[model samples]
Each structure stands twice: as structure tokens, then as C-alpha cells.
Target: MKRLLLVALLLFKWMTYAQTNLIKNGGFEAELSYWRGNDIATISPYDKKTGKNGCTINQYVGEQWKGIDQIIPLPKNTIALELSGWVKSDGVEKGKNEWNTGKFDIEFLSSGEKGIQNESIAAVVGTTPWTFYQKRVYVPDGASKLRIMLALGQTNGTLFFDDIKAIPITQEQLNKFQEEENTKRMAAIEPSKESKVTLFTNGDFENGNTAWRGNASTSNTVTKEGKAALMIQSSTFDWNGIDQIADVPEKATTITISGWLKSEKIQQGKDTWNNGLLNVAFAGNDNQKTGDDQNISFVTGTTDWTFYTKTFPLPSGTKKYRIMVALGFATGTLYADAINVTFN
Candidate 1:
């Protein structure tokens, strides 16, 4: 009986080893021996969550774009692949490119031709604690190689990566994992009906741009009534804006939108193309333009904190409305606070 049990244990070990980890030196245990990139190096800073050494890009001063990547040949009969790792950051910010947020990317090549590409499931930003990120992709026919990349583009910060792994997985397993994740996320954000009634969830900016979407950021430089406010700074005639969508209360007839805005060195360029202005607009559920578009043009020059209000009748068939505040096509800084939308 003892010899039979020993044989079974040996077979189980072989089976586990057969499920290979395609990535080499994934933990940076060998200290950058297998990774390649400019300004990429292995760091001795052990991750608290994983308790392992991590790889970092541009750990020292002198902010510049940097990345690390590894290319591995794919084995035969592979169906799908999953890449996962832990990432920690400090003071990471977005760059000129919309996808500039520090992230990991995976690319598959077939006969030296690109086939599949994807980035981390979510953007890594601000001072984040050690968090796990993952991406999964189907292996296309004739795929020959896979490239794994960790990148930071035009952003200032320190990013540490650890315990990276790439392995083959079944499509059913990937779908099960994604469904579990979505269910967890939905449960976490489930709020009471009273909380859902408000149109703008983070209008006060107290939650630090939680529901607002835009190229802007949250800052403590100026606040009408909170610890933080939305700040938008532009160096060119680019329209930087923030917006949110709120559900229209049933039987609502009118909606009123109000907010406080301030600007600094706002310039109205030589032509309409360069004009800078603060604009607020409301759109219907189908994203069609509504009659609620309002603007306070920076053509009037710099302005102190001012209150703006606009009321409009809810258009027929409008199930929800989107509110957008933007610093339109100019160079300047704009601060906004206490945005509120109400229904009668």
C-alpha cells in the first residue's frame, strides 16, 4: 500500500508540472535577467502583498517614458492565454495620450505579424496600493510568439510589478472568472434607491472624481465647499472636459443644472478655433443634443468664482441625461465645484 501511494503522488506532481508557466523569471527573482527595456531594473523593494522582489521602470528621478517587455515562443496546441500580476504605484498621472496610464500590454504575433493585443483590465492611477491586474486573450491560428509589456508613458511616478505569470487556460475557465468578477463588482456598488435618485453622484467632488469622466483631475488648490475640486489645465487649444450621466426621475418635467466655476489666464485664441470657454450641456438618453447647452466663454477673460444656473424642460422620451462641463478649445486653468442637477 505504501508503494502504491508513493507512485500516485509522483504522478500528481508530474501532472502539475505539465501545466507550465510560460513566462520566464516572472518574479524578478533573478533581478532583470530576462526583461528588456530602457531604464528598467529589478528593485529590492519587496511587495508587502506578495512578499517578493519587483521590477520597476524609472525608479529614480528624471521623468520620461519607459517600458519593459519579454517575448516568448508559444508552444503547440495552445488555445488561450492569461497574463496576471500585481502592480503598485505612487503619484502616477495621465499623459497627452488617452491611453497613457501606466499599464501592462500583451501582444501575440503570427509569423512575425501582429495578431492579438490587449492592455490591463483597468487603469493604474494615483497612489494605489498593491493591486492585481490581469488580461486574457484567445490564441489566434498560426500565432508564433507572445510579447508581454509593462509600460509608463509620459507620466511621473514609480510603478512596481511582481509575481507576473502567463499561462494557458481554457475559454470556459476565462468566462467563469470574468463573470465572477463582474458579479462581485456589481454587488459592491449596489446602492439604496435614495442614493440612486440623485442625478450627479459626485457633484461635490468630495469623492475625488469617482463618477466623472474626463481629462481633468481632482485638486485641493481651490474648492467652493469641500476638500477638493475638479481642475482642468491645458497648454493648447484642446477641449478638456468632465461629464456624468444621471437617471431622470420618473415623471420629471423640468431639470435645473447649477455649478460654480472659476478660471485663470483663460485665453480666447486668435480665432474661433482657439476660443476657451466653460460649457455645460445636457444630452438625451440617445445622446442627441438637447436645448440645455450653455457656455460662459473665456472671451470675457479671467474670472473669479461665479455661479451659473440653467433650467430646461425635460425633452420627451428622455430616460436619462448626460451633463458635461468643459474648458473649450483654449489654454488656461479652470476649477469647478458643487455641480448639482435637480428635477421638478
Candidate 2:
């Protein structure tokens, strides 16, 4: 029995190792070996909720870029990347500049680790519990590397960080990262034209129910490229459809929601519930709706494939974004595909 248990334990460890992603030492389980740190950053032992050590930074001196840095190499055909981590703070205060705050900064690099361009960071400030932060970006056409810096830029605070993750976006994910200009602009836009990033999990349905859950079933019969869930509603208030909850970066600016929709035999929902529509609700870390839901209504009755794009302000303290391609309380069959959410 002892030998059997030992084998089981080893198998579990191997399984975990096989799942390791692009971000090295992501959970800080191995201390600070994989990172280069300055004087203000050190390892916080065994305080993380995951039972792993976390990297902590003390920003007292207002000017030193004193923190940690890690460089990630990218493979060819990598179109975008996803970043996420957990942050805890105590008595944090912003610096003189708007960009100076406790946060993660990403700067793209070319071959031989040369600088390409710096991406905007979502500032982390104030006292807070363990908060999850995430960002997604489009990779430059010829870029080859990424530098992730964890620092309290010009901000005075104590921050603890763990579970840093950086994942190269898949082809399916890139399908959802469309291009968008300002909210009022009306013109043809291409995703590759602007900042290449995302906070929304790619719901392009190309991966077939990868990051989505709920009653709707994945179907390829009527998809853009023969993919997406077969959206149907069995009853009202049951929220019968596919939905996804994704993490958003703190202090992110404009949020653009874009997707494709197809409807058939749709009817008015009970009371004033919109029939076939895309409903987005902002939520906190607990996954409970914290504000009223917003909608991009779909035309009633049958319609061919129609694309939609909506841009709105990122609500304050929005930790989780709830996206629903719901039928509301209406009886209908619709298909929602390639739903992409991006933030500036």
C-alpha cells in the first residue's frame, strides 16, 4: 500500500508539471530563481492562498523601478498573449503621475531582446484583498519577445503577488480580438491596427465550449466556420444559453464588445425581457452581478448572420465580466459566435 501511494503521488506531480505554461515560476513555488529583482522586491514565504510563496514589493522610494522582471519568448504564428495574476496590497497610494501605481507593465521586445514598444498597464492601488488581474494583447507582426515587469511605479505601497500567468493566444482566440476605434467612430476597423490585447476570454466558439458553460450545447451546424453553440431557450429566467465569465484588468479604460449573431423564429420575451440579445453584466470576484446588465439587442424573427460591435466604459471595481448570449425569457433559437471583448 505504501508503494502504491508513492506511485500515485508521483503521478499527480507529473501531471501538474505537464500543464506548466509560458510563465515560468508563475506560482512562486520555487522562490525567486526565475526572476531578476531589485532591492525593494523579495520573496514572501508561504503566505499565498495557494500554499506557495509570493513575491512582494515595497515601494517607498518614489523613483526607482525597483521590482522584478521576467522575459518570455514567443513562437512563430503567435498572434496574441494573455496575462493574469493575483495581487494583494496594504496602504497603497498612487504616485504623482497617473501611470505611476502598483501594477504589471508589459513591453514588447524584438530579436536579441531589443525594445519594440511599451503597452499600457492597469494600475493597482488602494487597500484590497487578494484581487485577480488579467490582460490580453495582440502580438506585433514581427515581435519575438515579451518582458513582464512587476513594480510599484512611483507609487508607495506594499504589494504581494502570486500566480502570474502569460499564455500565447490560440488561433481561436485571435478570431475574437477584432479592431475598434473610439466609441463614436463609424468606419471599417481591423484588429491588427491598434493595441493587440484582450481581457475577455475568446468566445469565438472555435475551440468548442472551451471557456464557456451553461445550458446551451456546442454545435457546428450553423457556425461561422462550422463552429459555435446551438443557442436555444427551453424556458424563461432559466438563462438558457452559453455564457462566459472572464477577468478584466484593473483600471482598464474603454471596453469594446464585438460578436456575430444569428436568430430564427425569435419572439418577444416575457414582460420587457429582450428576446434574442447579448447581455453583459459587470460582476466582482465572487461572480455575482454588481450592476445592471447591458444589452445589444438582436432583431426579432429570422435573420442571417449579423455582426455587432459595442463600446462602453469599464465600470470601476469590475473584477469579473459576465457575458451572455441569452434568449432572455423568450422562446427562440439563435447562434452567438466569435464574441470578443477588448479593453484599452
Candidate 3:
């Protein structure tokens, strides 16, 4: 049993490692051993440097660059390269090439070129006492040589570099990095807490609002003397055939419908006992349909605001359904907040 458990643990670890992605921090380190200058040696005063703890190169103007001066060889399978370094500008801001900015620049040199193709960095020295800067470069295939230069760019003040790195990039790694960035952007737009959407107005039936239709007459769809209401015309009585509704998937296994209900009068002919009862049915006429209990509806209060809830199991062959708050067979005013459907 102990041996079996050990094998299982190793398998689990391997699975986790395989699923993990690149773009991880602190993956590679730069070696300053190749640097060649009297006044420069790679230094690390910034906290982002990978292995050497705070490795950095100290440089002074007119004394030749003193930081890490040599490029570390690329890995055997390396396809792309990204060179990043941190520099604090104390020297005068100068230098106009790819390698340097205000305080320091990094250069990449290939085997065939002698001038600065190996990649160099020069920076415009700033007066902030010390501030960090970073840069990244790409490398091509079949390239064998790499080098670093500190004084390639012209500047007047002291410059320092730390935490230098040369990283290998792959398509998969780039894609993963892009995906992480996209996720962060999306998370900022709609936080998980605000995922639920809410609408407070009662479809504009009350407050002198005119967004609802009733009995083919717009003049009295709303009332100020008593309670406001929404009425369905006899010609437009079918619930599923209504225009404001959208389709729900037939395979939806579970559903919940909840809203507020208050009515002074219900369909005029039905028993007053069942007048306030609301129904959510697939068919307009329950008698014509299966008349089964698959539909959900309830009646709660007569004069004041009352909450009502209904949940039902869907039939295997059911196609589409609509939400309805109908008075049995009577006529009356119903104020409602149509909040329906929550996904698990």
C-alpha cells in the first residue's frame, strides 16, 4: 500500500506539471562572467533580478562601462530571445540607438558583426538619484554569438544595471501570456460581484409611464386614482405567442420564476377564491393543453404588496415556455416585477 501510494502521488504531480503554463516569473538568470570592461560589471540593485539576488553593474562616466559585459549563450533549443535589464539613470540622459536610453542600454552582438550587432544598451542619465528601467529584445534562429555593452551610447552621468536576463520565447508561451492579459482586462470590466442584473420599474405601467399595452387602448393603460395595471387583450391572449418574449432551450432541466403580486380584481367570472391565482403555462388555455401540473402559478395578496414564487419540472418533449401572471377568469389590476430564471 505504501508503494502504491507513492506511485499515485508521482502521477498526480506529473499531471499537474503538464497542465501548467509558461510565462512564469523568475525562470532564467543572466551571468555577468562574460562582461569585459574595466569600469563595468553587471550589478543588481533592483529586486526583480532572478538568481544572483541583487546582482548589478556599477558604472561611472569617462571610466568605461563596468556592468555585466558579455552575452550569455542561448539554450540549445532556443527559438526566440527576450533580453531585459533594469537600469537607474544618474548620468545625463543621452544615447540614440536600440541599446541605450537615458542612463544605460543593452546590446546584442552576433558572431559575424564586430560593431554592435550583438545588442548594446545606452541610456540618458537622469537626475532622480536612481530609477529603474526595463527593455526586451527578440533573437532569430541560427544566431550563435551574444554580447553586452554599457558605454555604447553617449551620456554624461553615472549609470547602473541590475537583474539582467535573456529569456527564450515560444509560440505557446506567447499565447498563454496574451490569454492571461485578456482575462485580467475582462475581469476589470464586469467584476464577479456585479454579475446579477436588476431592473426596478414595473415595465412602466405605473408612475404615469407608458411602456405597456392594454386592451388596445393607450388612453387608460395607466391610472393615478388607484393601482396601475397591465391588461392582455382577448385577441392577444396566448402567452407563448407574445412578442416581448425570447425562447428558452427545451432541454432546460430546472427553472424558477418569482415576482410581486397585488390585485383588486381578477378575471371577472372565476371564483373569487381562485381569482388572484397567477399561472405560468406552456399553452394559453390549460384545458386545451395537457392540464398537467407542469405549469406553475400562485395567488398571494388582495390589497398590499405580496411576494409569490413558483417552480416546476419541464416535460421531456416540451419545446418553449413563457412566463405569465394571469388572473383566473376575472378582470382586475395587477402590479408585478417580472424577475424570472436563474442559471445554476
lDDT of each: 0.65, 0.65, 0.40
* TM-scores vs. true structure, each candidate: 0.43, 0.47, 0.35
Instruction: Please give the range of 10 consecutive residues that has the lowest summed lDDT in model 2.
Output: 177-186
Give the range where candidate 3 is weakest over 10 consecutive residues by summed lDDT: 235-244
Candidate 3 local lDDT, residue 214: 20
Write the residue-wise lDDT of candidate 2 on 5-120 in tens digits: 64355334323422336878878888887787645577777557466588888866555556788898886666556667888887778667876677777888988898887865
lDDT by residue for model 3 (109-217), tens:
4566444444433354454433434333444444655554555243345555454445564445434442342233223232212334222234324443332212122
Q: How many clashes does each candidate structure show, in the order listed?
A: 0, 7, 63
Instruction: Name the candidate, 2 or 3, with the larger lDDT value.
Output: 2
Candidate 2: residue 112 Cα off by (Å): 3.1
Worst 10 residues of 1 by lDDT: 181-190
Per-residue lDDT tens digits for candidate 1, residues 26-50, read: 8887777778873465466554345
Which ranges of candidate 1 are over 4 A from the true structure?
1-19, 48-52, 59-63, 113-116, 170-344
